[model samples]
Every structure is written in structure tokens, then in C-alpha cells.
Target: MRARNLAVVLATIHRSGPHTRASLAERTGLTKTTVSSLVADLLEAGAVTESGAVRAGERGRPGVAVSLSGHRVAALGLEINIDYLAACVVDLTRTVRLRRIIPADNRNSDPAAILESLRALAKETTAEAAAAGLRVIGAALAVPGLVEGGMLRSAPHLGWRDVRVSDLVDMPFEVDNEANLAALGELWFGPRESDFLYVSGEIGIGAGLVVQGGVFKGTYGLAGELGHVVVVPDGPGCRCGGRGCLEVYAGQDALLGDLGSVRELVSRLESGDQAALEACRRAGHALGVALTSAVHLLDPGTIVLGGIFAPLFPWLAAPVSGGLGTRLAQMRGAPPDLVVSATGSDAAVLGAAGLVIQQIIAEPAKLLGL
Candidate 1:
């Protein structure tokens, strides 16, 4: 009961910003005495701090403002993309303290070697976080594949199947799909929307469904396989053994391969290259078709284009919107709001950190344990 009250007070302050003891009591429905006790405990634990006093009115004395401390508890976020390995440390205030990304092609590479590299990176990140006076309570890995029971079921891009991530990382950690984590990151740290479809456009296309602030993983933890959705029944073959999958048209390789490199492609697009514009248009249309299916089935409130899609949103938005507007115009007042991710490509990594922060929020005693 005491631990629960402590969490309530902390979460209240976290959500509402600086709050006085009396205000916290009113918000939490706890007595002022209990709120004071909990706030004291949090202050001692370094989980929260007291700011300067806030004047209530002309009659009453100023009350001390209490807010979450940014220097203490932290979580380590890790990501393993086909082209890069990234790590970030985020505090309770959602401030990123340290981040590092290394370019590496993990596709067809030995899993053991990849794990060793990640371990080294994790060790370095943890040390740096500790030096910053932050305790990393937990770690999470965002993989570009299907994760079930802490094991990667399959990553067509990485060519990894049935690999146990726990065996690879010695520390206590949680594993999840990169797209799912990116959705959670956006939910927890970005717009704070309750329902949305987060599409990740990387080397492959994937999506994560956020329903009421929770990721809706299907029964097999493969709920949002947007990349595999068949947009063209008899189109080009996909790496996933499917014809005309969304990834075939919109994925990084498909869109950028013919142009030589991402830099060259972006330069050409800026220069009004007809081919580049045409490619983006086609990719946007494919994305719209897949997203239309998503909307019809789930009817989410918003659609977030994340990962590499964010950078290309300027060129992709019009086509995507045109397709969705034409298809869904019959049913609703307006098509769902399509927005680029605020975190850009960093969403997955930050979302991995959010996994740790979520556990601590759910059980404040975990902070005591740390």
C-alpha cells in the first residue's frame, strides 16, 4: 500500500509537472499528511526534487514546488538495425543523456559476433550513464524482427531465426520489435496519443499499433507486419516470399538502390529529379494502400510516419494523403491525421529506454531495489 501511494505521488508529479504537497494530495485523493510522507520519501530517494516556492494567493504562504528529478534514475535503450547499432540513456524527465550509433551491416553476420559488439556498446553506455549520476535500472533491445518470449522469432533482413536475445546480453533486459518500440516511444515521449498506427520505414517497412497507450501485439507478437501486407498481388517479389509487399516499393533498398546512395537520392530529389520524385510518389501510394487497410481494420485516431519516412515526409505526405483521402473519404468526417515522428530515426532507441521507465513507473519499489 505504501509503495502504491509512492508511485501515485511520483506519477502525479511526473504527469502534472511541479506540484505542491497540497495539490498532490488533491490530485491523488490522499491526505495531505500521506502526500507529505510520500514526497519526503521520494526526495530522499532522489527521484524528485523541490523547486522554489509557488505563491498560492495573497493570503496563503508560498508552497514548495516538487518535480521529478532528472539526474537520478535512468534506462538504457538499445537498437540493432540491419545497418546500425544504437544506444541511448534517458532519465525520468525523458531527457536523453547519452546516445551513440554505429553503422554496421548485421545482415548475414554471425549472431555471436553481433552480440559481442552490442555487449561492448552496452557496457560503455552504462558506464557513461553511471558517471552522469544516473542509475540504469533496466535495458531493452529493439530488433528489426519478430520477438516472442525474449527470443527473436525471425528477422528476414538480418537472416536471423529463432535466436535467443537473452543468451546474447548478460544483463537483465527486454526484447521487442523495433517498430513496436518506436510506437511506444512516440506514445510515451512524443504526442502522447492514445491510439495511432506508427509506420517505420527503414530497410524494411513495418508498423506498430498503439491502442490506449499500449502496443497491440497480436497473439504471436507479430501483429503489425505492415511490410508484408500485399499491396500489389502480382507485383515484384519481396524478401519475405510475398508478391508486391509494401516493402518492395517503399523500403530503403527499393527506393534508394537505383539512385546509388541516400545522399545522392536526396540531392536529386532536391534538384527536382523526375525519377526521384516518381519513386517517392510510388512509395507513398503503396504506403497509402497499406495504411488504408490498417485504417479500415483498426480505425485508429492517427497515423505516424516514423524512421526514414520522417525525413521523406515532405515528398511522401501529399501522395499518401491523396490515396487515403480518395479511399476513406466516403466513411468519415476526415481522414486520420498523418504526422511525421518527432523523434525521427531515434524513436526505436528511445522507446527501448521507455520500456525500462515503464516498469519503474508501474512499481516504484523497483527504484528502491536499484
Candidate 2:
């Protein structure tokens, strides 16, 4: 109970920003003495630190403000995409300290190697942070497929079944679908709009739907497979054995195939490349069209976009806005705000750390053995 109380305090501080002991006590319904004791324990554990003095009236002892000791708890997050393995190291507050990307070359045997590489990267980053006086506590891996019970039941692209992540991960690790983690990221760090669709346009498109501040994962893990939605039934073959999926139309390689280099393509688009502009417009149009369908069906309040393609975003707004037709776009009554993620490219890593925070906060006993 003591550990659990401290976890609750820590999680609350992380989500609601720095708060005073009185506020945490009131929020958690704990006694002031209990809150002080837990805070002291957390401070000693290096899980939290003092920010400054709070002047909420000098009626008593000056209240000392506290914030999460992010530097103390380094979390490594790995987003395992179809063709790439992106690893990131973040603190407890979801601030990414380091990130590295590796291309997944071989499909059949790359999963093991990729997992191993991510562990190694996490180790290296942890060592560096340790030299700088920080400690890494845990790691999280977000895969592009169904992950339930902390096991990859199936990844059609990676051709794996029941691949227990612990077989390759030697450190404390957690796993979940990339889209779900993205949704969690949006909920935690992006907008607190209560409802939003977090779309990830990467090598293959995926979505994370948040309704009323919680993820709607349906019965299966494939609930957010927006990429597999048929844009054109007879357009192009998709890796998911689908014909003319949205991913086939708007995925990374598809965007890069017609434009050559992805970096150059992004640069030219930013610098007013007609073709680049057109492609993004097309993608945005398609996404907006898809959002239109989603709006008609689910009626979400906001549609938040996050991923590598976030940089070349402003140009895609017109097509997306026009495609939505101004009705049920986003924000309910106002025009939809089709903007890139403010959390930058490390949202996934941050979200992964958020997952750990969430799990630990909800079930404090799990952190005991971990």
C-alpha cells in the first residue's frame, strides 16, 4: 500500500505537472502525514525531485514544489515498424533523451536480431546516461501488430506467432501495439481534448483512436488498422494481403517511390516543390477522406496526426480540410485542425514510457519484482 501510494503520487505529478504535497494528498484522498511520508520515500528513491518553493500563502511552512525525477528513471522505447526499428531513451516524464533508427533488412530472421539490437542500444544509452548520473529502470517495445498479454500473438508482416518478447529482451520490458501506444501518447502529451484519432503515417499506416480520454481497442488488437481500409479495391496490392489498401496509397515507400529520396522530397515540399506538394496534398486528401468516413461513423472531436511525415505538414492541410468538406471535421462545431504532433518524433518513445507509468500506477505490485 505504501509503494502503491507513492506510485499514485508519482503518476499524478507526471500527468498533471508538478503539484504540491497538499494537492497530491487531496487528489489521492490520503492523509497529509501519509503523503509526506510517501513523498519522502520517493525523494529518497530518486524517483522525484524538488522543483522550487510554492508560495500558497505563508500561513505555515513554505510548500516545496516537486516534479518527476525523469533523469533518474530512463526508459527505453522501441517502435518496431515493418522495415525499420526505431529505439528511443526517455526519462520518467516521457522526455526522450536519445533516439536511433535501424533498418530491418531481413524479414524471416530479423525479429530476433532487431530485438537484440534495441536491447543493445538501450544499454548503450543507459550507460551514457549513467555516466551523466541517470539510471534506466525499464524498457517498452511497441510493435505494429496485435500484442496482448505481453506477447505478440501474430504479426503478419514479421510472420511471427506467439513470439514472447522476453525470449530476446533481457531487461525489464513491456510490449503493446504501436497504434495503441500512439493513442496513449496523444492522450498523455498531445491534446487533452477528451476525444481524438491519433494517426501514424509511417512505412505502413496505422491509427490510435481515443474516445472520451480512453483507447477504444474493440475486442481484438486490429481495431486501429486504418491503413487496411480499402481506398481503391483495384489500385495496388498491400502487404497485409489486401487490394488497394490506404497504406498502399499513402505509406512511406509509396510516397517516396514516386518522389525519389524521402529527405529530398520533404525538403523540396518545404521549399515549394510542385510534385512534393501534390503528393502530400494527395495523401492529406486521402487521409481527410478517411477521416470523413470515421467522423461519419465514430464522430470523434479531433484528429491528431503523428509520425515521420509530420515535418512536411502545413502543405497537407488544404487538401485535408477541403476533403473533409467542413462538416464533422474536428473540434465538433469548428473547422478541423489538421496539424502535426507538437510532441515531435519521439511521441512513441514517450508513450511507451507513459505505458510503464500507467501500468505501474495501476498495479503497483508489478514494480516490486521488476
Candidate 3:
């Protein structure tokens, strides 16, 4: 019961920011003595700290304001994308202390070699965090594939299958889908929306459904397979053995192949290149078609475009919104809000860090060796 109270006090402070003991007591519905005791315990645990005094409107003595001590505990977030390996360290306050991304073509490289490189990156990130007076409590690996029980079941983009995360990296870590991690990152660090569909565009497309501020991973941890959703009948072949999949139309590779590089694509779009405009419009239309199904099924309050999609959102939003608005106009009075991801390319890595942050928050006693 004490631990639960401590958690409540800590959570209240975390969500509502720095608070006086009296305010915390009022907010948590706990006695002033209980709140003071819990706050003292939390301060001793280094989970929180006194952030000076809060003025009492010219009435009495000032009360000390307590805030979370983010630097006391940090977590490492590592990501393996088809074209790059990245790492980031984040503290309890969701502040990124250090981050590095090395571009590598993982599609053709051996998985073992890739893991070695990622391990090196992890070591470097940990060293940097240590230098900054932060301790890494845990690490999580974000992969562009299906993850189950810390094992990667399949990554068609990387041609890897049935690989345990332990075998790939010597360090203890959790594994998760990149899109799912991105969704979690957005939820924890962005606007804190309770429900949304996060669509991540990269070499391939994927989506993560966030319901009530939690990721809905489904029965087999494969709920949001937005990439494989068919946008056109017999349109194009996808790497996933499907025709007319959304990825085939709106993925980075497809867009790059059609319009050269992203820089060039954006340039052309800005210059009113007819071909670029047409391509974006088509991609947007296809994305809209796919999201229409998602909207109908999940009925999320918001749809966030993330990853590579974030940069190109300016071009894609109108068409995608048009598609969704057209398709869902009859069913719902208002279409779900469409927004670009605030985390952008960093969403997965930040989410990876958040996984550990969340664990620590749920079990603050761990920090005290209790």
C-alpha cells in the first residue's frame, strides 16, 4: 500500500509537473503526513528532487516544490532500419541526452555484422551518457519487423527471420516493431493523445494503433499491418507477396524510384513539377484509401503520419485527407483528425527509451533496491 501511494504521488508529480507537498496531498487525496513521507522517500531514491520553494501568495512560509530528477536514471534506445542504425539516450524527463545515427544498407549486409555495428553504437551511447552523469537502466531495440518475446519473427526488408535479440546483441534489451515504438514515443513525448493511428513510412510502410494511451498489439503482436493493406486491385507487387499493397505505392523506395531523392522530390513539388505533384497526389490518394479502412475499423480520434512520411506530409496531407473525407463522409459526422508526427524520424528510438522509463516509473522501489 505504501509503494502504491508512493507511485501515485510520483505519477501525479510526473504528469502535473512540480508540486508543493500540500498541493500533492490535495491532488492525491492523501494526508499531508503521508504525502510528505512519500515525497521524502522519493527524494532519497533520487527519483525526484526539491526544485526550490513555491510562494504562498503572501500568506505563510514558502513550501518546497518537488520535481522529477531526470538525470538520475536514463535508458538507451537503439534502432535498426533498412538503411541506418541509430541510438539515443533519454532521461526520465524524456530529455534526449545523446543520439547517433549511422547510415548503412542493412538489406545486403549480414545480420551478424549489423548486430556488431549496433552493439558498438550502443556502447558508444552508454559511454556518452555516463560522461553526462547519467546511468542507463535498460535498453530497447526498435526493429522494422514483427517482434515476439524479444525475438524478431521476420523482417522482410532485412531478410531476417526467427532471430533472437539476445543472439544479435550481447546486452539485455527488449525488442519491438519500429512503428509500434514510434507510436509509443509519440504518445509518451508528444501531445499525449489518448487514441491515434501512427503510420510510419520508410523503405516499407507500417502502422501502430494507440488506444487509450496504450499500444494495441493485438493477439499476435501484429495488429497494425497497414503496409499490406491493399490500395488497388492488382496494382503492384509488394515484397510481402501481396499485390496492390500500400507500401508499393507510398513507401520511400517507391517514391524515390519515381522522383529520384527526397530532396529532389521536395524541390520538384515546390517548383510545381507536374510529375512530382502527380506522384504525390497519387501516393496521397492511395494512402487515403488505405487509411479509410483503418479509420473505419479502429475509429481512432487522430491519424499521425510519422517517419519518412513526416517530411513529405505537406504534400501528402491534402490528398490523403481528401481520400479519407470522401470515403468516410457517409459513416461519421466528422473525419478523424490527421496530423504529422512530432517525433519524426526519432520516434522509434525515443519510444525505445520510453519503454524503460515506463518500467521504472511503475516500480520506483527498484531504484532503492527495495
Candidate 4:
């Protein structure tokens, strides 16, 4: 392996614990000499510095302590959903620093609008970071669509198909399905990014899945279309040419069908309006029904709730719990518990930011100037 690449591997081990050169070599499957060479490179690069000397209780020379430089890189994330767009700045650790959102109109079949918006938002986030003395290196955009090979497959609500985002957005930006980014955030924050499914309920519904730490994107980019999983064979027509799709009942518009807006609907539900309560229960039931199939197939450890509908989640908790309760009862145990995302709108944006960081880590060769 290249010494520079191996140097990163060594630094990672060092940050993880007090590892010896032998242990680093063993962990990375590199020769002792290779590890030593790489460690020397790291020392020279200033990406790693000896913290002090560790005195092992033995005859060996005192071990040198090392730590990562962690250059304080900042990233930006943007979430483009059905009716709104969210932007946020995050650190390499996926912590959101600040965020903003605006109403999005997906008309004219023009992805250009989104491109312009992303550039402006990214610039704004960079300026904000600079003012705060932060250095931003990359950005990630999350969209409610199937993303494949730098292209958007088709977002039924966004009314865009086969669009190339790489050509549209500016430098150091990567785009992916919004749910996937949510899953990333959840994975890092959840008990762990284990075999789990993430359900994001907003103006539209989408899913992100992680079987292990890695995301499982099916043959096409639209593998985990859990939201579109039919809850009822003939419940209602969905824009995606399906009947009883969960989105028709649990999506943002579903909660706002006859209301002023989703925010007001949340308030009504909060007040326990019998009508609003019923609607929330129905939405929950539909969500549970769709989830039943996924739970059966994936058997995820947990399900995460996010987006506009998160606050109304408590209203639907009973139905969701009941649905999962009855299903899991067949296997003899309590139902899987649900988690409301504390990240809210910022989650998706930060998820997008995580994408860029993940990319740079996965392919360091693409990373310039250390």
C-alpha cells in the first residue's frame, strides 16, 4: 500500500487507542516496516504528532504517543424535499453548526433552480463558517429521489427524472437520496449503524437502510422505497402510479390535506382534535402496515422517525405501537421502539454533509492538499 494511505490507517489506530507498531501492523495487515514507514510519513506530514512518550512496564523503549491533527474541516448539507429546502453546516463529526430552510416550488421541470439554490446556500454557509473561523472543505446535497451514479433517478413529487446533479452543482459537493443521509446521521448517533431502516416523513416519504455500517442501495438506486410500499391495495392513488402507497396517507400533504398547513395540523393534533387525532391514527396505521412488510423482510433493530411529521409522532404512537405490537406478538416480545430525531430538518442537511465526508474518507486519493 502507498505510505500516505497507510499513514492514515496508522493515525486512525492511534486515535482509537494506545496501539503499538506491531498492533497497528496487525490491524491494518501491513508489514512492520511498512507501518513504521507510514508512521514516519505521518510524522513528517504533521497530520499526526507525538503527544508524549508512553512508558510501558517492560524492557522496550518508551512508546511515542500520537494523535490526529483533525484540521477542523467543515461541510455543508442541503435537503431538497417536496415543498421545502433545508441547508446546514456541519463539522467532520457530523455535528450541525447552523441551518436554514425555504419553501421550494418544484415546477418547470428545471433542476437548474435547485442547482442555483444549492450554490447560493453553500456560499452562504461558507461565509457563515468563515465569520465563525471555520474552514469548509466539502458539501453534500440530499434529495428526495433515487440517486445513482451522480444522477437523480426520478422524484415523483419533484417532477424530475434522469437529471445529472454533478453537472448542476458546484465544486466539492456530492448528492444522494435524502433518506440515506438521514440514515448516516442516525447510524452515527443510533446505538450504531446496524441493520436498521430509517423512515423520513415530510411533504413526501422516503427510506434509508443500513444492513451493517454500509448502506444497501438495491440494483437500481431506489432499493428501499419503504414509503411507497402499499399499505392498502386500493386506499388511494399515489403520484408514483400506485394505490394505497403510504405517502398518500402519511406524507406531508396527507396531514395537510384540508388544513392550513402541516404546522397548523401539528397544532391541531397536539390539541387532540378528534378529527385530527383520527387522521394521525390513520396515518400511523398506514405507516405501521407498510413497516410490517419491511420489518418482516429486513428485521431491522430499530426504526427512526424524522422530518415535518416528527412532532405529530406522539399522536400516532399508539397506533404505530399497536401495529408493531400485534405483529411482534406473533414472535412473542415487545414491539420495536421508535425514536424521534432530535436533528429535525437539520438532520437531512447534515446527512448530506456526512456524504461528502464519507466520500473523502472512502477515496482519499480524490482529497487534495491533505
Residue 3 lDDT in model 3? Answer: 77
* lDDT score, candidate 1: 0.88
Per lDDT, the best of the predicted structures is: 1
Q: Give the per-residue lDDT digits (tens) of candidate 4, residues 120-232.
A: 77678788987875567677778888788778877767888888887544567677888878877676544553566778887678787877676788877777777788988
RMSD of 3: 2.3
Choose the strongest candidate by TM-score: 1
What clash count goes with each model? 0, 0, 0, 0
Instruction: Give the per-residue Cα lDDT of candidate 1 at 114.
Output: 91
The residue pairs found clashing in candidate 2 are none
lDDT by residue (tens digit), candidate 1, 147-255: 8899999987898998888754555589999999999999888975578899999988889898877899999888988988999999999887889999999999988
TM-score for each of the candidates: 0.94, 0.85, 0.92, 0.84
RMSD of 4: 3.4
Model 3 lDDT tens row, 220-242 = 99888898999998788887787
> What shift in Å separates residue 68 of candidate 4 from its native position after superposition?
4.0
The models' CA-based lDDT, in order, is 0.88, 0.72, 0.87, 0.71
**Ranking 1 against 3 by lDDT, winner:** 1
Candidate 1: list runs displaced more than 4 Å. Answer: 55-59, 167-171
Position 6, candidate 4: lDDT: 54
Give the TM-score (vs. native) of candidate 2. Answer: 0.85
